[model samples]
Target: MLEVKDLHAFYGKSHVLQGVSLSVGRGEIVALLGRNGAGRSTTVKAIMGLVSAQGSVRFKNEEILGLKAHEVARKGIGYVPEDRAIFPDLTVRQNLVLGIKDPRKRGRWSVEEVFSLFPLLAERAETAGGVLSGGEQQMLTLCRTMMGDPDLVLIDEPTEGLAPKAVEQVGEFLTAVKKRGISALLVEQKLSISLQISERLYLMGHGKIVFQGTPGDLRANEGVRKEWLEV
Candidate 1:
């Protein structure tokens, strides 16, 4: 439901995304695999109007390249940054409440459903969001975005820092997102998790997509993995 074509973004004349192109279909999980500085994050941010970009960012068959960030979000596209952004002062429940633009405009997610998915959140519903651990904060961020009820989400490194259990929780969370009929463009460094969950993967290098194929195709291409994926 999201398509980015020849997207190029700039940071004060320093070009980051060099003719990047990709797409995420309805209910499909597409992983953008790359190392730091590969422009994977820029691809998503540019699509969301967070960066100075010139290209075609189409959502649900409508072009949204030059729209403001909030305008882009209003069109049913949510973004979860690499560094978990949670309210420091608000309670967990209150933070989630802020995600809902309109309580009456119930889309696909609810507070109860989010709490059910992460009981820790339910237990700490009244607790201050800033006091939670890194993993808990990650869960909170993802849940809050779900509360917005977007059709597609751009998640940047959801498991960047966490214990194995929390990592697994994130995996389960993505599965639940798909179950709710939401697609995602996942920007991640972990190949194992992406390979396990994503139907297709795109590897970026030097600010460009170097490989695009299914999990099986990616797994079989050892050269591509070595050059673009391996540490």
Candidate 2:
């Protein structure tokens, strides 16, 4: 339910996104794949209005390009950055509470529901976020964001820096999110994990989308993979 059209973004003259266009339909998982400096993360940030952007961004068929970040979030979008910015000083419960909306809306999710998705967070409810391990912090950050009850989530590098098993857990978690009818715009470098969780993939190069297809189609297109994604 999100559409970005010919989006251009920059960081004070260093243009990072050039005519980037993509769409995530309802209950669909779309992976945005590219190497470093390909502007995948910038695409998400621009959609959130975290950076100035040119072009059209529509969420639920409403124009959202110029809205503030919170305004965008209020329109049923959640973002989990690669850094997993958990509040170090806050307890796990506190961090989760921060994502909770007041006077919860009809379609909103609750803390208990989020904990059900990440039970480890429930066990560490009282622990200080700073003292948690990297995997735990990542889980906490994701759980915190889920508490927002978003219609669509933009996740950046959910598997980065984690152990192999943790990466698998992230994969399963994303799969669960998909089954729950949550749409995702995933930006990931780990192709295998991303393919496992996504139905469609978009390969980007030099700040633009070069290929868009099913994961299986991408696997079969050795030529496109070599030209746009090979290291």
Residues 133-166 of candidate 2 have per-residue lDDT tens digits of 8888888887778878889999988888999878
Give me candidate 1's TM-score against the actual structure: 0.98
lDDT for 100 (candidate 2): 68
lDDT, candidate 2, equals 0.88
TM-score of each: 0.98, 0.96
Kindly list the per-residue Cα lDDT of model 1 for residues 1-231, writing each as its tens digit.
Answer: 888899988888788889999999999999999989999988988988888798788999999999999898889998899998899899999999988867888868889988887999999999999999999999999999888889999999999978999999999999998777899999999998899889898999988999999989998999999998788
lDDT per prediction? 0.91, 0.88
Give the best candidate by lDDT.
1
| Colliding residue pairs in candidate 1 | none
Which whole-number lDDT from 0 to 100 does residue 164 have in model 1? 93
